[model samples]
Target: MISPRPSLAKRAFDVAASASALLVLSPVLLLAALAIRLESSGPVFYASWRVGAGYRRFRLFKFRTMYPDADQRLKDLAHLNQYAAEADAPEASGEGCAACAALEEGATCSPVLVGDGGEVICEAEHRRRQNAGPAFFKLQDDPRITRVGRFLRNTSIDELPQLVNILLGDMSLVGNRPLPLYEAEQLTADGDGARWMAPAGLTGLWQVTQRGTGEVSPEERIALDNTYAESHGLGFDLRLIAKTVPALFQSENV
Candidate 1:
């Protein structure tokens, strides 16, 4: 099925806003780039694959916020992940796996891995889940973050480069936030993958509402994204942009 395109006005706005921001923030962006270089030994910019609107893959740009070997160190730091405890929780039997179970009543629960004959789970499937990270992963005191990284994260200066994404028509200024490849894989497994229909953006309903307070659950975040997908328009987008400024100042945003 062909994916629906974002509205003409929305696309136009994205181009205009992103270009204006990049031009206006040129100095700040330069300073951030320099700081990242001075404090780190890797490339100043960090680009990672992300799933954008309609499940399209695109490279997301950000100021490098972790040590050069952060990806290599992920496995070692898995235990420190805020989502580790929850991901490792005992598999939910009755209600927890209800959605998956409803589709196939006698199917072994994916999380539990047990079956009628003590059958082993598929190795590929198991590894996929393991590598998919979590529904949400945020560390309040992540050790991988550099000194300059912490400041960039706190001030959200690191995200300025995403304006380039917006200008490139890969993202919008306000819409549902895009997901990393792993996170996108997980979201696609959920029945509510329709949330991916919305244009990916730097600021969105969840970011404006949660503002890194970290109280929002994974399900809730997806729901918020779906809501925005269903209801968002130019006016709503403007309102979200207005709210974004204050949300950026929230202490937890760091």
Candidate 2:
């Protein structure tokens, strides 16, 4: 069974380590903030809703890596999503199937509908096609990243602000990485939910384990998270933290 609360020792370590890191990294944070402000005309920090341990929602902080209008541009860039198989799949042309075309604009051929690549799909075929992959959105060469943002993402300087999250008890130095609401929502349906049994974290098992492995499937990533959740403790946390430094300079901009 998952513990209802973090171990006292683990919590103490999270507090001390996060506090000390914030103190030591304050100047770096300030410089990063300054760079972001100078490079863009938006807030220096970006806070997006993330689902953490026990499905608690909180704003996850990061240096503003994308432009102010990044959210609005996401639909246009959906084809670039690395996790979406829809990009490679053949798309329906004209008005789509005769059954769907006969239905109203918002109506579906079946009672249950799935939206795949802007088209409403019948439930059975949708499930078959959707079994192609996970729902996580990622891009190999995202055009949204600002000049300074690329540097921050590559070096993971963008994640520095999350120390404040750890200090606030919303996260830990070592645990499963918190997921965006959309991503978390998808995981709630099955054994995949086991990934969230531990505290949310700044650096975790999958980040270190998949460091130079190019890209990991969402299923593989969740399994790593579940592994950490099942075995996490002070000793494991320290070991993972030690592995974190080398993994900081990641090849992927995620």
Candidate 3:
């Protein structure tokens, strides 16, 4: 399916906002680069392959927040993933959840299931079995994060380099957050590929609404991304941008 064209006004806003921010924050960006260099022995920036609207691939830039060998260490730290541990945990009834049921039946399970009580139930274990891991991985205290990395991640200074992405038309200031290659693959396998129709951004509805909260599962994040893709407009984008500022100050870092 073809992705909808972004509004010209939105593109105009992205250009203006990103350019102005980069120009005004040049000194701060430089200092961040220097800090990363001083503390690490690798490139100052990390360029990750990300899936954007229409499954378009692009390099998303961020100030390096982890050691150079961080990716290599992911397998060794698999046990430390909070989501993975949750999936492995016994349910309240000391039985397996939907994920286990589906896996036992040799069938795929939905990423989310709504209980009769309206609680969001996750089938992360099923996803892990099918996709080899959770779509969204977060560790509360990852050993891979350097001292400087933690501070940069907490303050979100590491994200400043994304302004260049916006300026280059690779992303917008307000849209659905781009997914990493691995995460995108799982979402596609689950029939949630429509979410990729949304423009990629540095901040979006999910980030503003559920930032730093562990309650939101990967399925919920995909649902929110699809919802924004379907309903977002100039007014909604502006509102999300307004909310993002305060959301950043929240104690949780997801």
Candidate 4:
């Protein structure tokens, strides 16, 4: 899993390169912040819990691409999505089926979002989670993305702020895209999927590859991600990074 550990050179390169990218990307970050402020009535940066290496938790930073409190609404709407996926999977193949089924079953107030203590934290997190709902894990025609948000996502500006997460050592520049704690928990339940040893990334092998069009099942996505995790090395990471370049510029991810 994750080849036990990255070589010293790879680790050094990841940290050093991430630090360098942060400086180069600062101007773009400022512009993104200003754009968010100008177009939306909410805070410029949005931070949420993401599962990372060793299943450790951290705040994932991104430009505010949706309205505030968008996640909770999804919990309210999970049933509808499940119905649609179930209907479509018989024709489309059973990719996200099991994962979605598992997820939809637990749409209650998740402990990760609930914070360390009581109802107030839980309720507060519920609201924020609801706000982030429209763009949850897998999406098609999400209603929560603001007009500007759509533009930002299309041009990849929406993910730029995640560079900050890279700098804080919460993630890697290339690896698996971090899942929200709930999704990550579900993804790893099938132990030693090669997923347990990896950190969440700004972009990853799965994003560049399996993030292909259509509602990719979480099961398939995890399979691909774990495969990469199990085999990742300098050469493989280099190849994933090379593929990511075009995905970044291509607009259509897959």
- Scanning candidate 3 in windows of ten residues, the lowest lDDT window is 122-131
Best by TM-score: 3
lDDT of 1 by residue, 1-254 (tens): 32336788888888988898899999999999888888769999999999988899999999999998888987687777676555544343423333344545545444546433675453223533455456666666888899999899888898989999998888888878888887788787555687888889899999999985767767778899888888777789999999999998887752
Q: What is the lDDT of residue 186 in candidate 2?
A: 80
Cα deviation of 47, candidate 2, in Å: 0.6
Which wins on TM-score, candidate 3 or candidate 4?
3
- Candidate 1: 10-residue stretch with minimal lDDT: 90-99
Q: Give the TM-score of candidate 2.
A: 0.82
Pairs in steric clash, model 1:
none
Q: TM-score of each candidate?
A: 0.82, 0.82, 0.84, 0.73
Q: Write the per-residue lDDT of candidate 4 for residues 118-165, one digit (tens) a residue.
A: 522333244343432222254566677788788788778888788777
User: Tens digits of per-residue lDDT for model 3 on 192-253?
Assistant: 87677778888888888898775777778888888888876678899998988888887667
Candidate 2 residue 18 Cα shift, in angstroms, is: 1.0
Backbone clash numbers for all candidates listed: 0, 0, 0, 16
C-alpha RMSD (angstroms) for model 1? 4.9
In model 4, the runs with Cα more than 4 Å from the true position are: 1-6, 79-136, 251-254
Q: Candidate 3: deviation at residue 106, Å?
A: 16
lDDT of each: 0.78, 0.81, 0.79, 0.65
- The worst-scoring run of ten residues by lDDT in candidate 2 lies at 87-96
